[model samples]
Target chain A: MNVLFQILFTISILTNGDIKVPNSGFQPGDKASDFDLKSVDGKNYSLASFKDAKGFIVVFTCNSCPFAVMYEDRIVELSKKYGKKGYQVIAINPNDPEVKPDDSYEKMKVRAKDKGFDFPYLFDDGQKVYPAYGATKTPHVFLLDKNHIVKYIGAIDDNAEDASQVEEKYLENAIAALDKGKEPVPAVTKAIGCSIKVKSK
Target chain B: MKVFTAIISLVFILSASKAQTQVLPEYDTYDSLSAAVFRNNDTTYVINFWATWCAPCVKELPYFEAFNKKYKEQKFKVVLVSLDFKRQIKSHLLPFITKNKIASEVVIMNDKKYDTWLPKVDASWSGSIPATYLVQGDKKLFAEREFANLEELEDFIFSFSKYK
Candidate 1:
């Protein structure tokens, strides 16, 4: 695996194509906007209901992404650990079913059911929510306070492929900070995962 | 099959035109061109590498298009590279690029050498989509995450251009 990563790094250096995708909407310290996304059971889940929590966690994730799937246990652990502490964890599926059918509503339901997700799996139909939150990658996490203020925005952990070796749990720290009424020091970290599939115009 | 072919044809025409105007000829292998790729040739090169199946890649493409419009006269060029499979050159690459109407230079670097190629682009890149590298006048900055808006994008460009 180290050799593979080294080779990939070399290729990136060697490839004449030296550029990255550009999107500026998702950044640290941005105020999180309220969302009225529909949950799996056809009910709307809004930020208003969780306005009283010490903090809220909005993770722009999906059912099919390996990065997201690996975090399933941790996400559940997060919800279990934080939900009782007044932090709401909501998962949003921003993929276009017309393009990627595996991310369709039904698949989301089955995956959620099969995985025993304890969080709300919401669907952003027109994709009006992710850009507001500036979510560019899957399993992209946004930690907010009770006032819907953004505390942290980035990956859930340091390691996506290997959960065991995670050195820094970014999301967990953000929640902990919010719980303690202090600002999260390292508010943004590198999130290695699949990108959110916005509808191509 | 007729609809599919029509779409494919449309995609090809669009991408080819953009490439003629903006995209440089792609370097397929990851072991080629390390220093020259970022050698400030007086042209501000914007390289956006993404795949068809990547959602974040699709999400941020419009920003590249917008950047092209905002900086066309200042020796600024946006180059979009499709990181799909080589097989997609005919079936998926052309149509996706064409239909997107991406006015920037578009090329399909359909090589599976990501493990060998992703880091060469930038050591910070975690093999993620929507990653970007901005090069201007011997200055280079790579952003592993996504940007939020045009102002931020412009700031990144201006800041890097000022580098010693």
Candidate 2:
């Protein structure tokens, strides 16, 4: 029975696309791979593009996701507060336009304009960057230091519904730790958000 | 004239009662929700963590509903744990549930401490919705994505529970 069960489990993993294989993306302490993707402002941005920056707050987000929408203002606030401090916020829409039309580059440009986004809201065309980073959902954040080492990988903060009631700012704290030349305490966190839409195989 | 008025009022009351009959999902803290799913029993439980705001989760909900209905007589249960914001319970969550007539046992997980509760649900979970947990006694399987169809969902449960 145990042998049969093991065989069944293995087959399920093989056949089921929903079954997540462990550790498919970057973890804390792992160096990130840089990518050049197009932003809504008609500019190409790679990690090297921000030469004067200290680190990057690469947030995987999109226009349609309510959770992402909830954090839109906060994301902007993060950029404004930390941009001068040398941390650049590079928001990426990693969802496939075919799967989610609202996440298409055109709609992204609309969202960016409407929200007055002060950061690069880039489209991960062909859906390559997110998989490489192992980002599973929109509003998923990865805070990277100047060396491109992933300092934190999770939510922007604890409260996704209302920012005024936020108790802990995970990404901000992580960035602060990196600024002070120390490791982020609780470097990894998680939050409920929309899964990164991809074309079904 | 009296008879006509009486019938019209009866219809109004009936429709009003029907509207009131829609189930409002109970709000649960993470510990209470966890306790409910981790019950020690012979029945197999498929706990799906989702929300109305999550498109993929909303799309895949019918599969769970169908599977639960199909296996109504068996030792199986489907518990839909909604991660929708507590504030939106009335505005969005309840209305969506009523509009779709989602019959699965739905409850709102009103916990915001993802760093604490997410790992408790599954160490591998990265806090994404449309995730599911199938539990029966000591055996458990966690899938972090949406099921494509009813057959796929059934296969996932059957793999662990051996339920037909």
Query: Chain A TM-score for each candidate, in the given order?
Result: 0.84, 0.89
What is the C-alpha lDDT profile of model 1 across A12-111, one tens digit per residue? 8677454545455645556677878888877899888665777788888887775678788888888998888888899999877786788898898998
C-alpha RMSD values across all candidates: 13.1, 6.2
Q: Candidates' DockQ values? A: 0.10, 0.47
Colliding pairs, model 2: none
User: Compared with the real two-chain complex, what DockQ does model 2 have?
Assistant: 0.47
lDDT of each: 0.72, 0.88
Chain A vs. native, model 2, TM-score: 0.89
**Lowest summed lDDT over 10 consecutive residues: which window, candidate 2 chain B?**
B22-31
Please provide, for model 2 over B1-164, each residue's C-alpha lDDT reduced to its tens digit, 9 standing for 90 to 100.
99999999999999999977856556546777767567777889989998888888888999999998999779898899888888888889889887988888888888887887888777788877899998877677898988999999988888888775
- Candidate 2 regions exceeding 4 Å error are A1-21, B1-25
